[model samples]
Target: MEPDFPLRKIIHVDMDAFYASVEQLDNPDLRGKPIAVGGSSQRGVVSAASYEARKFGVRSAMSSVIAKRNCPELIFVKANFERYKEISKAIRQIFYDYTDLVEPLSLDEAYLDVTINKKGNPSATLVAQEIRQRIFDELQLTASAGISINKFIAKVASDYNKPNGQKTVNPEEVIQFLEDLEIRKFYGVGKVTAEKMYKLGIFTGRDLKTKSLEFLDQKFGKSGNHYYHVVRGIHTSEVKPHRIPKSVGAERTFSENLSSEIFMLERLEHIAQELERRLKKSKIAGKTITLKIKYSDFSLQTRSKTLPYFISDKDLILETAKNLLYQNSLENSVRLLGISLANLNTERKETINGEKEVSVQLKFDF
Candidate 1:
């Protein structure tokens, strides 16, 4: 652990194949069978896959066509978001028993700051273990956890032994664990970023550490700073209970491809209306409005404009989206239309000084 960064006990709890597992848990016949939680249509995408489906290379975000090609017998099940939310609420209640500092990344995953917990537990590792056990015992669902000194490390460690397991990165082993970790395994390093790192001869954290801050900045811009610090075990981000969303968006994938600009305008109006409703529900507005287009061929494009003043009205959002839709000629027939608002009113625009030396012990009783 870096001396400059504050130490805190963080645990990242991630449900194991959440959606697919839920489907299996509710239906006895679906258990141990290869199932995908999504439509098995050409236009549909797989939202999740059970462990049985994963063995055949079926995964979330994969096209249903491709997933079927991978596994001929893969069963496709429609997603039940309402039921999933019901289970998620129950799971969160279990977290509230241990700590108040719970940051939900999504319905299936969250970060918990349990440095000072209700149970008066000194070991974060044991706390995570108990949480996982409670989830299985009460909900009949499995979850994985990562216990570590910071949220970033804990998030990555949580995936180390996934699908109903947990891993803890002790303070003394943080440096070595990161050094040996593959670049692709680092949190926030997606396939494209991993490819970029590989091209720079940075296949591992040890390789990333060899580059100076200036060099990484030149290569990756603002994200380079994040990479440089995280590689050295210096992520200082706290586990905020009320996580502010960076953007609010709504998109619709049409049942059939739409070609006419007039038709798209109608869809954009509907999308903007939905966006406005979401923004209003959250009591948020944004200065930036972006229109996302997904073509019939599955190609994607986005156009954005930033306004001087925030707006959450449906008419305003529709007006901006309509303008952006007309800003450029369509490359192909559009299949999906989306509107997103960024530079939100809820964002905390404060900066944290990274150089401040905070001396806190990384190793607790664990």
Candidate 2:
């Protein structure tokens, strides 16, 4: 195995139950009760669930109907993305005060490259504590931080102590820490990969390390090398601060799977409307329209088409999605439907005669 890579301090900060916590913080009655933030209908899904709700097997992305069935007393609340975005901006400002090398994974989680911070603090653990404390002091919300030599390890460590806590794995401990971790705990090992690993008798990092690179490559393809290297404390992915999203999409999972082609158009229209809202909000358009379907049996498929011009119109998106949906016969009762736009035309803000202009609205390149 390769020797441990050069030391670089990275910190991963994640807010615990951000949306549900915000609801509890804003409303007095929800403080200590199980709550879910999302639509509470036959077709609605949970965007986030509080820890209390989780005890009854409630989880984000779960059908609201099932969540209610799991916890009869679970309270449902609407998601307030606008308020969440405001708080997210405030938290990002705090991150900026430390370093410009901050990569936000979402509204609630980010990774920071703190090898050389503005505070001139040598210890990453101390820096994480100070950041967490400041977030609570200013925003009235708690965050957990994980400090380690790289982003991968830091991300995993941050989850070690959740809900307003911090954990640090120094350079010397990186190897042992990884060796003792379960295969399921690895960052990229999802349900499918874990099952594949189990079939190969690889249940832990130590088991993974025992396999030869050639064998792993045959078993898991490109990800085989990724697993081998990361187990030996060798993840080289840098903290990317200005990463742009490649595509924008939304999907809805229903309480009951849909089988009829006639009833599918209504769901497709709803998803198209959401895609339109997102496209406009992001100030971008795309030429490619893609449709994703997840079958009741847990299989998935996608079909896409590229248009002659970029579009953000709901009618056009709905028609395109409708075409993709009907292009093939219904494979199975579909549990989820998703629509997305790719090959984006994201505009940049520019100053024109002292007035900022959106490049797309002018219909010309600068």
Per-residue lDDT over 25-121 for candidate 2, one digit per residue giving the tens place of the 0 to 100 score: 8998998899999968455779999999999999997877799999999999989999999999999999989999999999999999888899998
Worst 10 residues of 2 by lDDT: 357-366
Give TM per candidate: 0.95, 0.84
Give the per-residue Cα lDDT of candidate 1 at 115: 91
Q: For candidate 1, write residues 1-366 as lDDT tens digits.
A: 338656789999999999999999999899999999986756677899999999999999787888999999999998999999999999999999999999999999999999999999999999999999999999999999999999999999999898899999998788889889999999999999999999999999999989988899999998877887887778878899999999999998787789999898888888888998898999999999999999978889999999999999999999989999999999999888899999998889655436332333354566
Clashing residue pairs, candidate 2?
none
**Alpha-carbon lDDT, every model:** 0.90, 0.85
- Model 2 accuracy (lDDT, Cα): 0.85
TM-score of model 2 (CA atoms): 0.84
Model 2 CA deviation exceeding 4 Å by range: 1-6, 41-43, 252-263, 266-270, 280-288, 294-301, 304-320, 331-336, 342-366
TM-score of 1: 0.95
Worst 10-residue stretch by lDDT in candidate 1?
352-361
